[model samples]
Target: MLETRSLTVRFGGQAAVDGVTCAFHRGTLTAIVGPNGAGKTTYFNLISGQLRATAGDVFLSGARITTLPASRRARRGLGRAFQLTNLFPDLSVLENVRLAVQAQAGIGLDFLGLAARHTALHDRAMAVLERVNLASRAAVPAAALSHGDQRKLEVAILLAMQPRIFMFDEPTAGMSVDEVPVILDLIEAIRQDRDRTILLVEHKMDVVRRLADRVIVLHQGRLAADGAPEDVVASAVVQEAYLGVRAGDV
Candidate 1:
């Protein structure tokens, strides 16, 4: 559903993402894995339009969107969540999600119709909160929630956008062991749909093995290995670049 053609991003003398080309098929979960400085996040930023490509193009569903801004890409069904929690710290949980729903519906700027639009937006937001298991805390301030709950709320905000393509950058980062499964399950639920395309960048090999239908390995800003999780993880090149070890040692 998403394709990048020779995408490159150069910062002064360094190329963070260098001519990397790949495709993410519909209804599949693909994991992008590599060691630090592998250009995984840079590639994501290029595709999501958070960072502009120095060269090459990004296409969503066959249409070129290399120059589209982040907001425009989001409007076209591209949704992203970062490694860190991002939300309104002071807003009630429900209000945070409600605002996302409102933005998706393009009613946030409709001051004249807000009263009529709010009721529908509230219901939609509540439904999304329920999906993320945060309905009970809908009235609580986002800052008051646990770290894991805050992460879940971020997912809820994405769900509120009703995206067709989900790009998650370490959705479970920094969570306690007990909280990991909850976030993982929520991501798995999104993957259950056969029409949505999901791209994930996760450091947890177990999570990648359990969740990804395919794996794309990056090393030094290039596509190193792209295949099944077992094959990619077992690759000598991947092991060497990612862990400085041979496959047998793994």
Candidate 2:
């Protein structure tokens, strides 16, 4: 559960996210959609502490975290996966996720201490890899995998962190038609968990339709429509802003 209160971000004379207030309920998957430059990602950055808000507040579970740094926010149960692939190309897939698991568990100091702890870490990482269907490729270097597999590795890393709230920025950004469904199915599996809250910034309408319990549409840095996917998609304002057509035309 997360809430934003009148969140605003401005760059010089332009407001990228303007006074947007919304709530993300527990166990719900919400999609944030809009055209280019709609401030969807900007809003994410603000809430995740990647970008400082010019005004307003961000709350996680009821506590205000507006001024918390990104790392602190992450430690407090916030997980983010960027649109771009970010991983150590040289590291094996298992190694990459093992590091995440170790970091989250604060096992860095004891990393070399007990063989048992090391084994535990490896088992946990391998479990996450298995969940993403990358267990077979655990020993391969991340760079050697296909682009879609690499994206799945990113999710695997986030899963290792075990955050209560997940923020995914364009999880299906670049992939072939066949690959998209695989990632979408993985996301759907995440949504099946009743204890996690997921917020996604996605462009694929089909993905949104299939996964989003609620849809929040943004236009020119402002809230355009917020409701069920079908209702929001059929809205006159959403159609005019995103489809460049009047409501009656639909």
TM-score, candidate 2, is: 0.92
- List the pairs of residues colliding in candidate 2: none
lDDT of 2 by residue, 205-238 (tens): 7888999999999888998899999999888887
Please tell me which predicted candidate would have the highest TM-score against the true structure.
1
Worst 10 residues of 2 by lDDT: 241-250
Q: For each candidate, give its TM-score against the true structure.
A: 0.94, 0.92
- After superposition, the stretches of candidate 2 with alpha carbons farther than 4 Å from their true spots are 109-117, 245-250
Candidate 1 versus truth, CA RMSD in Å, comes to 2.5
Per-residue C-alpha lDDT of model 1 across residues 100-186, encoded as one tens digit per residue = 888788765665765445698899999999988899999999999999899889888988988889989888887889888877888
